[model samples]
Target: MALLEKLTPGSGSFDNREKIQNQAVSQTFHSAVNFVNHQYAKGCEHIDESTTVCDNDILKSLAFSQMLDRRCSIRKPHTSTCNWILETDAYKHWLQQSTGIFWLKGKPGAGKSTIMRFLYNRLRGECRRSPEKGIALEFFFCARGGELQRIPLGMLRALLNQLFRQDPTARQCIREQYEEKSSAFGYGERTWTWQPQELEVLLQDAIVTAAQTQPVTIFIDALDEAGAQFLSGLANYINQLTTAAKICISCRHYPTPPYIPGVEVRVENHNSGDIATFVNDRLKIGYLTEADSPDSMIWEDLKADLTKLAAGNFQWTDLIVPLVGTKIAEGESPEEVRRCLQIVPDKLGDTYRRILQNVIRQEDYSQTFLLFQWLCLAQRPLSVTEMRYALAAKDMVKSPHRIRCHETASFVKSDERMKRRVNAVSGGLAEVVQLLDGDKERQIVQFIHPSVNHFLLTEGLNLLSKLAGDGKELLAHQTSATEFTSNDTVQRCHSNLYRCCLNYLLSEETPIRTELGQVPGGSELDVRCKSSPWHEYATRFLFKHAEEAAKYRVEELDQGIWL
Candidate 1:
């Protein structure tokens, strides 16, 4: 009332007084709008601050160098290969629904991971086009990758990292807990690492906070690769998350995860069309465009047979198609090509065995068997350069009296040459993967696929042992004379690696029992690390392998003397 009285003139002409009153009203209206704008700006600033906090050191601590290795390493779906899943009712319903879980199940090499990648990419595009809808998070399980990539802790870290990045409010929900831990313990990734249980709790809190503003969708591929022990717990936890967000997971048909109520899309049932399309695109039949061409009928029949034989297995189709193309390219008659395709074992396992026996030369059997043993049961995945040193040491171990580390490097092949050697020895079952670690490139050796690893561990190992006649111990499972179980066989593998580690450590090339003087910008230790690829691995994992080898007692190593 006082303000109003002040604004009105005490004595003035009526026209001037009315004009002054109107001006006062106009000024008040503008002031209110400006105040509201100021408050809104402050709110926005707070949100930005929260998001910025989430993007800082705390957030980075949750990530690791190999956290995204499997996810990014996955190959994108071929053109039009995964489109069929989009049109399925199960997929459509899952996408349109507000909240639920979806399961995509398939046999090994049936393209479950590929389909998961496709769906993730589609939702990612949708979110990009209309961000208000929600965000997408993905983690691909890799059994052959580093320990983190195959464990639950890694998955949670990856998902939470995405959630915190997308929703700043979500960061606030867990900030107190994070800070409390940080204060009680200490800072820095080296000092403190998040346990699996702690990560799970934080992930739950983050989802609840984020879901309040928008929906959340998660895609986890190759769940089976995470191992059987974690499957049930992971499924139950995923079920709980469905109440707050949508979840999708892919795994093999066997060792099925505990039942989580959701739509199940069996990839094999719906991938026939995709298989047919792939066959048509890959098979060399376009030149015989004329319906009456001499070879047209044969090519058509072969295409049909390939699709039918594939039985909805994309990997099988992928393998056979190239062989068919190769035969055609060599100017083989249509009948001969068709005959060759027919002989390829319909089952993937048999086909793998055929490949191994047919491609590897007789003289290379022993070395090849050793390579498979190293790949299948090594404590960790070996880099290509490390593998070269490892193989050389295996040869030198036969004559430990003449052990020379310098000679080992001389025998080591270039990365490309070693890659070809691995390919030849494993008969395409193993491959060398080049990865980027910061500014450096790393070449790692692994099986071509999970199924390949599966085969090698079981009947594949038995078969290789028989062909190579490497040793009686290699026949761990099948030999009735020696009643060693599969576990015993694995221990023997460890025993072999242990001996190799010992040989490498004792070599003259090793810089053991020496004080590394600190130099400007680097130390002698740094030089040794660069020059000696196997030295660090041997020292770090030597005792671990010895412990594993202890399970199956080696008669020579039983005595506390150098054999």
Candidate 2:
């Protein structure tokens, strides 16, 4: 009788039970409504406003130098390009899915990175416009960059950091976890490190918790570049996350991903129109855009031929289009340009080798070779200013009589001019990019593509050496420096760099200035960089290069040590 009475009307326990059920239903209904409304809304002015985080230390710790270097370096997709993917059923379905995986596969030099950048930007824009529940994050894997850029651990840390920024609850969870781990390890903030397992668990937890309220989307580029050791496990984990989040990964066709449950889009299959449009726009031929022109058919045919030749390799098209444009500008017939394309090699490596041979003359060989060495083996990406100083130091090292630092004014002229010079010397294999270093902007040099870096390191280096002749004085401290065996090329390069760093540091003419800069509000480091760009790099990496040089024990080091 007492239990029946408690369950009846005016019973406190029954009223509480009914209220709890109603709250659960209401929460579910609101979540569903928010999701559908988000999908249908074509335009929105704000994404979920919860992503902003005030905890600077955690964010800084999670982000590493050069984390965004590769992404920033990618060329923006041309207008009207990469729009085909947005209309695809697979893409639309993936976007609507609460949890899904989308894979974009391509051949090397097929413009996969460019496509990824386009998609990331587009999605980010969409989320920003939608005053709904969505978060967008991206990471571009750079094989030629620091270890963190090419590893799974770095990817996890970056993604988790981004997640914490967007989700306050997750951020609080991270802060608590960080404190607990610090206490357990008895390590100060400086000594604390994030292990991979802990990050993985935290990411899973964050995703699950975040999904209850909103959608999270992540774009990862160049999975093949990310270390192969963890790719299979990583793919599996990502697949599991599809229960709550959406992921898109781009990778080269080879070293195929171990798991294959995701929707796969072959880059070449869908990018032919984009290639044709790019060629037509970039070829610079007359009447190419006029649909009604009598001669337009001829140009269209020409564009088609080049597009077919590209075989979905946009990089190949990019190289050929400019060459064709140059030929046409020089008054060469379209037939001649077509003939030129026919002779060019189909393989990207060979294509690069050919471009290098054509652009680098005998007099420019040593500088070109040295530039490649620096790009391939530097401790970090070189800023434009540092590269200019490096090349200058090389010449000064060769002819000590001219070992004087030029004024900053002289450098200012070369800042823009040097970019052209670098392109000319490197056959467009290396390019300068402007990116943010905290609040400051820096122009750094990197290879046009990772394949270019690989080619130079493996085949291009030896080819340049053979072409330049054996025992050549390549940035030698002394004329009679040691010859480089193919086996010791890497070490010899490091040794040469070590020597250069020493010459740069010990040279009495080279100023390591301490005065405040003319530019107001500049940091001390910025002032130092403006006055002497190479000083910071040479000081920081002198020992690092020296250690690498020790592997071969170059005699140059002994001379450098004494000098």
Candidate 3:
């Protein structure tokens, strides 16, 4: 009975025997496969070894190939003439020497980021071949307002994570460090007790330790967008890590990163060749080519003119290429195209205005103008979602109210009380309101760009003032209406009206300055102005009663100022 049971599939001894046999067959198969793979890999290594290729030779060939590919890929193709001249021998030597921080500064659209991208691609390829000798590279692109507020932490986390991925030992070391210093929250959790300075020191130490295993390179782009204080801190941190790591940073010249006592490369002043090369490459990619067969000759002529107009500015090339290409596709004459390109405005504002005019017509002019104005006056560069949200909110508050009416007397008179009640209800709305209007998903209500704000506040404001008038007429009309008749109501109405006027006049508060002057006698105003409280009411009263108080002819005067 026991022997019969053992022969069956349910017997424990029979199952053990079958398992051992299966394990033995699997091991043999795996061993044969691994041996074949090892032999093939060795053969491949021998072939590579016998090729007699130097690392520099490989690097140079790769660099040239990349440049050629880039030039070929661009629509309005031009030879990358600038690469050789701008990225000079001196700069190459400096990059090779493991400089801690290399700050490349330029104006907007100056091709700083493009050059960085090229360098990053080259370094990344070099790193992959010899992991032990190669540098660990980390890249951070500071987008407009996306994830920028937590810049330092965000950068550190990204860099550390990259390093950890490259080296398992480094990851283990980071884990140990966290466990040693941090509270009981397991590995990878940040310690609350660590101050910014301490955290920076810790990061520097960790990065240096990682570099000891392999060289490390960190690339940070758009430092200006990252905010001034954060950039300053980053510069200091990179300086601290100079002994072990290399950092390449790019930013606009306006808010340059703090002087970190390292190699500095100014893109605008020195990297014109790189910019020209980039423009030429972009042109090669059909960016300057005619789409239709009829305009082939015109496209060629337009390309030549555009190359000159770009003048080593990548932004100019980026803007003009599409326009010229489209015109050429439409069979425009080369001479006509050149003339049009020549007439195009040089400044960013002019370009923006041209684009605006093209997108909107006469009937939609007011909405578009107001949108531009709001963008110009905003505190920060808001996303499309934020801008839409803010606009919708403002519209809600300013929109006219509709009220229900009840029938009254034989005289067919309106219920004055009901009218007043409805008016009061409308007047009591909130200052800032939120609505899911427009594209609900985008939820924009803020300005398009920070520069737009500057433009609106200065040039746009002047233009709008001419169009909308001084606003005095609107104020007078509102004041004379029943809304401001009662003493209790007058103060609130006047204050609200003044606030609205101020908002229109000054998007941001400017410093206030007070001027004192004597008032003449026999004026309709009573200027019993005291110097005690420098309030808005006092300023308003003085200004409002200035004509009337002229009859008094006071020698002394007190003017109040507020921001």
> Taking the tens digit of each residue's C-alpha lDDT, what string does model 2 give over 1-563?
65445446666644677768766866888899999867645332222352222255567768898778999999889778999888887788877777778988876677889989998988889878983748888889876789989888888888888887787656666765665665576644546778888888888888888877778888999887765566688778777777888899998654446866768788878999999889878875563344455555666688778888776778878766877767766666667867777443346776577556643556667778878888999998898878887776565444425355453222334688888778767755677778899999999998755557766766677777665554565555546434456778788788778777777777643333334323344455455556777878876787789899899877766762443
TM-score of each: 0.55, 0.52, 0.45
TM-score of 1: 0.55
Q: Which should have the higher lDDT, number 2 or number 3?
A: 2
Task: Write candidate 3's Cα lDDT for 1-563 as tens digits.
Answer: 64445446656654677668766866888899999867655522121332322222212211211222221232432345335423565457556775467777655555666766666666788788767555655444443334522356555555555565565446545544444443354323333333345446556777767776667787776566555456677766667777888777777653445677656665545645544455455555354443555556645555565555554456656666667556655657677667666433346555334323322233333334434444443333333333332222222223234211111111112234322222222111101223455565322233222333444444543443233232322221222322122222223322323333233222222122245422344221232222111123333432333333343432212323122
Ranking by lDDT: 1, 2, 3
lDDT minimum window of 10 residues, candidate 1: 473-482
> Model 1, range 168-189, lDDT digits (tens) per residue?
7798766666666766775445
Candidate 3 displacement at residue 282 in angstroms = 6.1
RMSD, every candidate, angstroms: 20.3, 22.0, 19.3
Tell me the whole-model lDDT of each prediction, alpha carbons only. 0.73, 0.73, 0.45
Winner on lDDT (1 vs 3)? 1
